[model samples]
Target chain A: MGKVKIKKKSTFIDMTAMSDVTVLLLTFFMLTSTFLQKEPTIVYTPSSVSEEKVPVSNLVTILISSADKGKVPEGKDATEAEGKIFISFSGGMDSTQVAPVIRGKMLDEALKVYNAQAKDSKKIALTDAQKKVFQETNMLGTSFEYLPELLSKSLTEIDKEQGDMYNPNTGIPIDGNKDKNGHLNDFQIWCRAIYTVSKELHDNMATDMGLTVDEAKTLGDLYNAITKDGTGIAIKADKDTPFTTVETVFDNLQTMSLNKFSLMTALTSEEEAAPAKH
Target chain B: MAEVQEHDSGKKKKGAQKKMTIRVDFTPMVDMNMLLITFFMLCTTMIKSQTLQLTLPTNEKVQKEQQNQAKKSEALTLILDTEYTDNNLPKTDEATGKTVHNVYWFAGLPDTTFQTNLLAKESFMGDTKENGVKVQQGIRKILREQNKDVMTNYDELKAQWKNREISKETFDSLAKKNAADSTLTRPVVIIKPGPNTTYEALINALDEMQINQIARYSIQLPTHTDTLLLENYQQRTGETVIRPTVRKSVVY
Candidate 1:
């Protein structure tokens, strides 16, 4: 009889298959991913059955901060933190009107309008470095008087300052500054600045492309994006927030003649009232 | 599959040749790829948010002559409100896990004297199935009944689209035209969200407009007449419908 020869197997794992799968997954994510824009606060938008998709570019988002219910300091009321407005602009897909460039131009135009309408003490004068910071900011939420100092801070400092909901200077002042009241509020000033800049950009693009207004309308131009298609300005508010909080934003938009806009919502499906099968 | 092997014939020559096997280890590569995937997954927003388009009449006041008034028979007003908890948060329904939103509706004009009891109350009950047949419930049912003329045409168009008889684009354009068809009898909806109403309640009301295919709808703040009707309803039903505003306006 022969002694049983024990065989030793190599202790190795062939990771080729694992690597292949992971590479495929990585590719999928890289191709399909859109980086989330950084905002000062997060809000859960109400869901709706409307199927219209938000446009990918040339959009202005108005974010309304909800009340801080969970963590309130000792003396302050929770509702005092509600209705703070923030504004962020996203430019077109093309290189000419990318976010940074559009933001820089908007700053210049807004400053001009604000300084013109604002009282001497309320005027905002930003240096070139501060303007650069403003261009890089994803969402801006400070009153006109506070803007010069807010933009001068470092990125982390700015974020920390704006994240404090109870800060008196944290939000853009959006009181009832009606158009018929003779002077525009800071919110209206921003709206007016956006309107002027977008109109100018649209006209310039139309002339440069040698396209007529009708042709530009078909080409997804800025004018159509803002006014005709009603997809440019989007109001994003929390689901649980009261209607009066959101209505103030709507009233301001209406005052600025931005009668047509969109509301951001998550998608949900409900059965149709019809008896037919979907 | 990762190993490379070379074979040499056992022949004596000027110099003996040695066989060699080459292998590549992919363990580190897999680890790095996993790390990258985690980063992308955390940083990416895969689902785009949906949008509902809305158009409000200009804030500028319009003269009475320029305003196209709806016929009294075709007018339907909805006053929306949301119940609030003692903590000032919106009170949620325990059964459905949805916030409690109440809809107070009246047809034609508000009867201030409460002689007709025209102001009826309804909640947003989306849909249900009874005895194997689909049925609409609550406020949706009422609105759909009022807009049956448009809904009938809409159902036909929807069926045609589902059967592949018409393209989606064609179906959409036709459906839009049918909704705006002036000849069909349609209800003119005025959605007045109360001060205590949540934004979600207002959105639900707007979504109803889209789902029911009602073309003429406008959002307006509640007037004094609406308040009077609510008070009457409260007195008759013994329901505490009116409350102080939960949100305090922030003034700089």
Candidate 2:
């Protein structure tokens, strides 16, 4: 505790290294970032304890959102006549109600894709140009009747002017109406289209793996060895959408014998709530 | 004359060098970088979404189940119904402040005995936190108690997995094995959402089923007996009740 020397040394420490590091990190994040895809609707998936990840490929994602009629009813035993989904209704069950709307753009790239060996364009009912657009665009919610128009329009133009063509309360119109031979609604037609296109891909893989196409349960099986657990159907619905809507969707699947599907939900990181327990 | 010129230039250069300094204050740059990092951190959705795989029975299968399995004790039916006062009519619940939801829960068929003891009317009151608490307190607690044995076994397996004594695959297999064991009691749950039941309550009920580890469960349509039970329940309670109606989907 002797002499208190008040010599002020230079306080400047070189932050050049730190700056370099931050810039590097920023660059890395910028390069690696995968931007969120613009969805037609904001689907707030319900939280759950189940942590099974959705399969990556050979999947058809179904997005379901509610259309609010006005103010939600409040009270015990409140009636749910307030909200209505905007979709064209066909007579099937109590199917007039609980219709959903989504818009899908057929990607142009898929129309160009044909069986190199067989060149079987006749198998499907669409012009090559139409098929190309159908394959290229994202499958949006629209009535079955509007599919032809959807096929004709350029997806990029639709993307730019999205709101003008927004058909409310319409989805791949499925009233669970099966034909004499068990053909479901527009939803099944969409699935058939996918299956027809993917047949070649599945066939090639099946052949490669020394399995017949017949043996491979492609449509309904969740854990198809050839597909490696591709659910094919991925349903993304808002937390508060009526179960009637979802059940009808399930009905559509059941009609088509598509039994297995995946329900998408947001993952909750448990570590967020952890106290300082080692 | 040249030596004199050089000496004057050198003197000029030395004077210029003394007056000027090259320095960069990077505090602003650092601040900008920090701001950007914070923005990205806040906006970025880091975690990937999870999924729940479900296999649904065909409509025919459900119909058969209703016909054949109603007598079974484990055949529990959970009908999710919405509440709107008759005055409110088609919709709109101006009278009640909370979103009125109810679950008409019962196990086995609506025999006189089953109706007397099995059926209970419960409200879907949001979660424990919210006044609308539809979480793990009411029907969930009851189901949890019913499936406690399997849940306990599954929990034990999970603990073992956490302690690194067993792998996840092993744990899952063991859990499956335990769930399938006939020695342990099992409850077959049937979930039926009325035409008006909000999607949230259905999901909450499904979530409850998973949380309680009740393995055998299904989403089914309400039967005639179920509807009758609801009518009886409404009459007894004298509360405005929404009836559970089937969607009449044909999947056979």
Point to the candidate with the largest DockQ: 1
Q: Write the per-residue lDDT of candidate 2 for residues B1-252, one digit (tens) a residue.
A: 101112223357546533333346566777788777766665555576777777775444445446545337677778887554445322333444334556778766566533464458875332344576333466766776677788779878988999999998998888888877767777888888777665555665666676667777888777777767767777778865654442222233
| lDDT for position A274 in model 1 | 18
For each candidate, what is the lDDT?
0.86, 0.56
Prediction-by-prediction clash tally: 0, 42
> Mind giving the per-residue lDDT tens digits that candidate 2 earns over A1-278?
88999999956655666677778877766665645545544556765556887654335677765443345445422222212222211111222211111112122212222222113543234566765664455546554445456667788754443322233334455575644135345565555444443454445546766876667554332125113443556777765556667777777666656667777776542221101111
True contacts kept of each: 0.77, 0.48
Q: Which residue pairs collide in model 1, if any? A: none
Runs of candidate 1 exceeding 4 Å displacement: A1-7, A272-278, B4-25, B250-252
- Model 1 TM-score is 0.93
Query: lDDT by residue for model 1 over A33-96, one digit each (tens)?
Result: 9899998888888888888988888899999998886689999998888888999999899888
Best candidate, TM-score: 1
In Å, residue B196's CA in model 2 sits off its true spot by 1.7
Docking category of candidate 2 = acceptable
